[model samples]
Target: MTVAVGLFGYAVAMAFLAPRVLPRLTRHGVHPNLGVAAWLSVMTSVLGSWGTAVLIAVADAAHTWLHADRLVLSGLHEAEVIVTGHEGLAAQLALLLVTAVPAVLAVILFGRLARSQVRMRLRAREHADALRLTGTRMHRHSYADVVLLDSAERAAYCVAGSPNVVVVTSGAVAALRRRELAAVLAHEHAHLMRRHPLLLTVTRGLAATFARVSLFPVGAREVARLLEMSADDIAVRRHGREPLLSGLLALSGVAPAGALAASGADVLARAERLVSPRTRLRRIRAALLTGIGVAVLAPLLVVGAASGLLLCLI
Candidate 1:
């Protein structure tokens, strides 16, 4: 019970504080990849702590019940007798109800996450298939194949899957200067090489499944924005900021569902950043890493401390 309470309290505290603290810590000044890591760590830590608490509660209850007959003649004999009048079975049933609530909820949450992943992957595959059939192959790059659509809309996006593809429309091909087109292709290539689509998919699933968490929804949006910025950084390194900025301004279309477009996310903010990039201080980056480490380790420390206490008590 002590262990369970400690775990539950830690989970609640982190869930409450993480949303408030993350925005300030992972602002645009920090590296976007680091920000993504921080957000994912928080989400995993909260859910893992909660799940661990539930499991510990159920296990402790079962252990106590199984040893009830022995415990009646052991160190806790007097306390057990005085506390319950030997009504161990009744107490066990009540404990079962308490543990069952979270177990059931955990199952439902996992089911929702699974469904979301399946639906997203299926949609991505279907979109890939459609693009393969309708769009003509333009380049056979090693990282991702390029597909040319006949449309006049300036659409440029990448569909991630087996044999990943970068799709560009005729309008974009005509509208983009050679340098701008290269920058745009580099952006989509960065997405494929880094598996940004998969990252977005997982975040999207977590947000949809646990929207009430507040942190999950906000993390989803922030992760998407940061990922786009991260890709922009990669594109800039290979093709310079001007070409990518020009490409950003020239290309305009909504990305297909489950596909990442060069023009998707906050284009205006990306443009501004390209115009004037800010460098974070070394100390600030160090502090952010320290914070990430603490957040990731704190839950495990709680569980360990609780277990040690339980052992000493026994």
Candidate 2:
């Protein structure tokens, strides 16, 4: 009974958590990036909660198995063991206090932080309303506008709003021809259309949380890179490979901080991949296969593993 209860708890936790984590994984790869520090912290706390729940459930199962003669009150005995050990009530209460407090605090703190970021983003959108130019219908929603700024630095950035505008400096505009500019716009549009800022914001919280708990940071960073590629694909599809590639090369020279530049980092490689028909086919095939595999395997694997562990202890 204890084992059953533990397994049930595990299932509930996974049901809530996996959906949040997996989408981020596919949308972005799992890597560490500097930008998502706060989000990473929250994610780490989330992951930590997951880890704690798993551990508690396993321990509960094992304890019940070891003390099968106790009253068959479902997994209550196992839970008691987690809180008090096999000793007296005082020991159990002490254990529960020690474990439960931090776990609850971590959840509350991280959750608050995530909410704060969301609020800030919403506020940023409100601020952007004042900046909207006349005759531009782009601000109707959170769609990024691609505009020119008077700064000396040539940069491409999304101001992030209902019509989240992507801004490009005149220097960048002058450097690229019409097609290249279109490609740049397409890439930024993909970011806006996908609501990437929100996604990235969440991911950043996760990354920061993970870092605090000393878990893996690579997952969040990888997600960031993949999101960039996904946006690149959108650009390539809309504007053609040549234009996107040219835009990447041109923007690489003048990419700036705090802005999503069309080129820089892995932009060139992404452009090359876009231009290569073979690479495109392979990427499509791989993505399809991965999606199918995950769809089929996730439930079976998660359930089977959790059940098998419970049975082994029982």
Candidate 3:
């Protein structure tokens, strides 16, 4: 019970403070890939903390119900011992019932996340199947799963699935220069290669499932924006910024409902970023890496420490 309360408090504090601190820690997107990682790590940390807390609560409840000695921290053990001594089996039964609430809630929370991912993946697969039928397949040295849709409306998006499809409209191909089209294709391919869809799925699912949690929603938006920037960086690396910038200008339109568009999120900001001189914030990048490491390992470390202490007592 003590461990559970402490873990829950830590989770709450992280959820409240991480969003405020992470933007500064990411150094305003000096490295977009690292920024995406940092945001995802923080989200994972918060959720892990809550999950660990619930698990600890259930473990402690079961331990007390079965064992003669309490398996919690000394403070919690002392208080619970007093109650159980006075109230006997009633107190233990009540603790078990109380612990069951969080366990049930956690199951529901994760179930919703799983359901959201399944629905999204199914939608993306359907969209990809339709595009494959309607759109012409392109043979390119760099990318093979390219589909050219015969649409005048400029649109470019990647459908993430088994093969990972990149769909570009006829208007985008006609509007963009050769180099610009290649850059856009690189951008979409980067999305597939880096598995951005899975990232977005998890983040957005968390945001939707835990709408009341401030960090989940903020992290979702930041992750989406940063992933676009990350793909842009990859495009620039393969084909210079100017071409990608032109490509973005050509396809400055929203994508399909369940796809990640090259010009999808924060287009103006991405264009501005492309035009601006690049800065290699080495120090900030190092700091961000450190922060990501801490965010990922902190909850696990705490759980390890508590387990070690319990082992010592045993």
Quote model 1's TM-score: 0.90
Candidate 3: give the clashing pairs: none
lDDT value, residue 96 of candidate 3: 59
Q: What is the per-residue lDDT of model 2 for residues 1-314, given as tens digits with 9 covering 90 to 100?
A: 33334433544554355445544434322221222332343344344435555456545545644675552454456555544346777866665565556556656766876776776677667645644552233333236544556655555656566666676666777888999988887887787787766666665555555454322345445556666777777887888878878777777344432234466446655665566544244454454455445434444455567667756765
- Per-model lDDT: 0.83, 0.56, 0.81
**Candidate 2 residue 38 C-alpha distance from true site, Å:** 22
Candidate with more favorable, higher TM-score: 2 or 3 = 3
Q: Backbone collision count in every prediction?
A: 0, 45, 0
How well is each residue in 1-314 modelled by candidate 1, as lDDT tens digits? 67788988988998888788887766563578888888888888888888888888777656665665665553676535533545576764565678788878888998999999999988887788788889999988777879999988997999876778899999999999999999999999998899899999999999999999898898888888888888899999999989999999998878877788889888887888789847665765786687689778898788789889878877
* lDDT for position 239 in model 3: 98
How far off is residue 207 in model 3, in Å?
A: 1.2
The candidate with the higher lDDT, 1 or 3, is: 1
Model 1 accuracy (lDDT, Cα): 0.83
Which 10 residues in a row give candidate 3 its minimum summed lDDT? 68-77
